[model samples]
Target: MLSLSGLALFAGIASAYVVSNGTTCYLYPESQIHLGRNVDDTPSIHQAFDQCGTNGTVVFTEETFHLNTVVNTTGLLNCLVELKGELLFSTNVPYWLSHSISVGLQNQSTAWLFGGTNVTFLGQGGSINGNGQTWYDENQNHSNQPGRPITITFSNSTNLWIENLRIIQQQFWATFVTYSHNVTMKDVYVNGTSNSRWNTVNTDGSDTWNSRDILMENWTVVTGDDCIAAKGNTTNLHVKNVTCYGGAGMTIGSVGQYPNSPDYDENIVFEQVRTIDTFNGAYIKTWQGETAGVSSNGDAGGGGSGLIRNITFKDFDMINCSLPLQITQCIYTEDAGACETSKSRYIEDIHFENITATSRYNIAASL
Candidate 1:
C-alpha cells in the first residue's frame, strides 16, 4: 500500500528534479510550434505527450500555453504531468463545440481527457484556465447551444493523483472522475464565477461517477454548484479538510435517474469540512420514482434504482450556510405530496457527527 505521506514526498521530489534529470519533456516556446499569443499549441502539446508519456514527465514551465483544440491523453501510463504554467483553453465556443469529445453524461463534454494508470498531475501552484466567460455569456443568451465542455476529466483510470492545482473559471464541472479507481486529489483549488450578467450554472468543483476507492482532501472550492458531488456507483469514497464557499456543499447524489438502470453508492465518508456562504453543508438528494422529462438539459429520466448505505458526515463547520444538513428523497421536484406518493431509493446507516453550523436562515436542518 502506498502511504499518503510517501506520495506527497514523491510528488515534491518529482516536481523538483524530473525536468533536470532528462526524464522530462519541457514545452519550450517555439514559433513553429505555435507557443505564443493567439496561437494554438495543441499539436505541440500532443507531440510532447507522444515523446514523453510513459515512464517520463511532461513539464509546462512558467509560460502560457493556449489550446484551441481538444487534447486527449487517454491510456497514459507511469507518467507525471508537471504544470508550472498557465494552460488556457480557448473561449471560442463554436470551435470547442465542434472539437470537444462528448461523453454523453447530462450533456457533459471535456476539452481535455487525462486518464490511464499510475498518473500524477502535480500543479505546484499552477493554473488550468478554462476561459469560461464566453461560454457563460453564450449560454445565458442562447440556452440551447452545445453544452460547455468540462475543464478536465479522468475517465476509466486507476491509481491517479492530482495535487496543488488551481482550476479557474470552469465552463462546467471543474474536474470529473468517472469509471476510475484508487484516486487521490489533495491540496487542490477551484474557482468559478459568472463573468456576464447571468449566473453561472453547474460549475461543480469535482464530481465522481461510477467510481470507487477515491480520496479527496485539503481542497478550497468556490463554484456555482456542488463543491464535491458523488453521483452514481461510488463506493469507499472519503473526503476531508475541504472548505467550500458560494456553492452547494458536499453532496452524495441526485441519483435514481435513467430508469431500468440500477445504481448504488456505499461506504462514503466526509470529515473536517467547512463551508462559508454555501447553500447547503451536507446533502443527499435523489429523484423520486418513475419520473420523466425532469432534467434541465431535457434528458429523459426515471427507471433507475439505487441503494445508498453506510454514509457518514463528521467534523463539519458551516457559517451562513442556508441548509446546513439536508436529506431529501425528492430532487428537482417541488411537490412534496407527489414525492410522498412516489417510491424512492433506500438510505440506511447514515450518520452525522460533530457538526457545528449556523444557517443564514433560521432553519438549520432540512430533512
Candidate 2:
C-alpha cells in the first residue's frame, strides 16, 4: 500500500499573485478567510501582499493543496503572518479506481523560500508532510542531486516561531532558517526514513546560519544527515532538550573562505540533548576548505576572526554514537580543524557539561 502520508501530502506548488498591490492579508475562521480549498480563498490567499496578519487564519482543514510556482511576499518588510492547520498524513482517504479524487497530485516541485517576519505556523497535533520518498528514490538510480523541494526562508526576519509540527521526508533540507533572530522551534520532528529502500539524503533537520537568539527544544530528529547544524556568524544561540536518533551528531561548522571574506561564530549553548544511534556525539568542528557539517560550521586555523566562542554543551545523554566529541583548531596548510587554536576572537567563552554516551564511537569530550 502506498504510504498514507503520500496520499495526503500536498505537492506544494503554489504561485503568489498580486492583490490590488496589497500590503497585508488577514486570515482566520472568523473573517472572510478563504482557505486553500475554496476557489475564493485561492485569490484571497494569493492577494496577500507583505503581511498575512490575524485578519484570518488560512486553514487546510483536511485538504490537500498544490502550488506550481513561487509564493513571493512582494519584498515585504517586518511583516507578520499566521497560518494554522490540523492536517494528518494518517487520515489519508484511500484511493480507489472509482475515486473522485484526481490524479497527477504532484505539483511542479520547486523551492518554497518564505520571506516574512513574526510568522507563526501552528499545527497543533498536525503536520505539513513532505513525502520525499520519490525524490530520494530518484537519486538511487542516477547521479543527480536531489532537488530542494520547498525552502521556507526567513531571511532577515525577527522573532519567528515554527512549532508543534512534524516535517517528514524531503527532497532536500527540511528547514533552513538563515539570517534571522529570536527564532524558536518547539516540539518539532524531522524524519527521513524509508520502510523499503534508502529514501533519505541531505535531509537536514534544521540549519541555522548567521543568526542569533534561538531556541530549539523538544525535537525528535531521525534523518540520514546532520541532526541540527549551525553555520556562520551564529551567536547567542541555544539548543536544548533535543532527541536525535541518527545522523552526524550535532554539527558545528563547515567554514572556509577566501580574501573575499573570513568567518566568525560565538555565544552558542547546547543542553539536555540526546544522541541515539548516531555517528558522532557533538561536534565543535570546523571543516576543510570545502567542508560541511550540521551541528556547526567554522574554519579551522583560518586567519580571519575566531568564528566560534561561548559554546555550552550540557546534560546530553548518548544512546548510540560512532564518534565522540572533537575540538581542535585546523590548519589549512595542513589538516582540517577549528579556526581558533592558540588565539580567541569574536568568540570568548566555551562551556560543556553533563553528557553521557549510551552507544557512541568515542567518549565524552575531545576538546
Which numbered prediction scores highest in lDDT against the true structure?
A: 1
Clashing pairs for predicted structure model 1, backbone only: 259-302, 259-303, 259-304, 260-303
- Candidate 2 lDDT by residue in tens digits, 124-160: 5545555567556655622214233432444566777
Candidate 1 wrong stretches, greater than 4 Å:
1-23, 29-36, 141-146, 335-338, 341-344
Model-by-model lDDT, in order? 0.82, 0.54
Query: What is the C-alpha lDDT profile of model 1 across 1-367, one tens digit per residue?
Result: 8799778655544433222345677774333233334777677778777767888889887777778889898888899998998888888888888778886566668889889899999997579999877777777733224557888999989999998989999877899999999999999999887757976677789999999999999999988779999998899999999999888899998788766666799999999999999999999988767676744434556546889999999999999999999998767666566477336578899999999999998899987
Candidate 1 contains a number of clashing pairs equal to 4
* Candidate 2: segments with Cα more than 4 A from true spot: 1-45, 48-57, 73-110, 141-147, 257-259, 289-306, 328-348, 360-367
- With candidate 2 superimposed using the best TM-score fit, by how many Å does residue 84's alpha carbon deviate from the native? 5.1
Model 1 scores what on Cα lDDT? 0.82
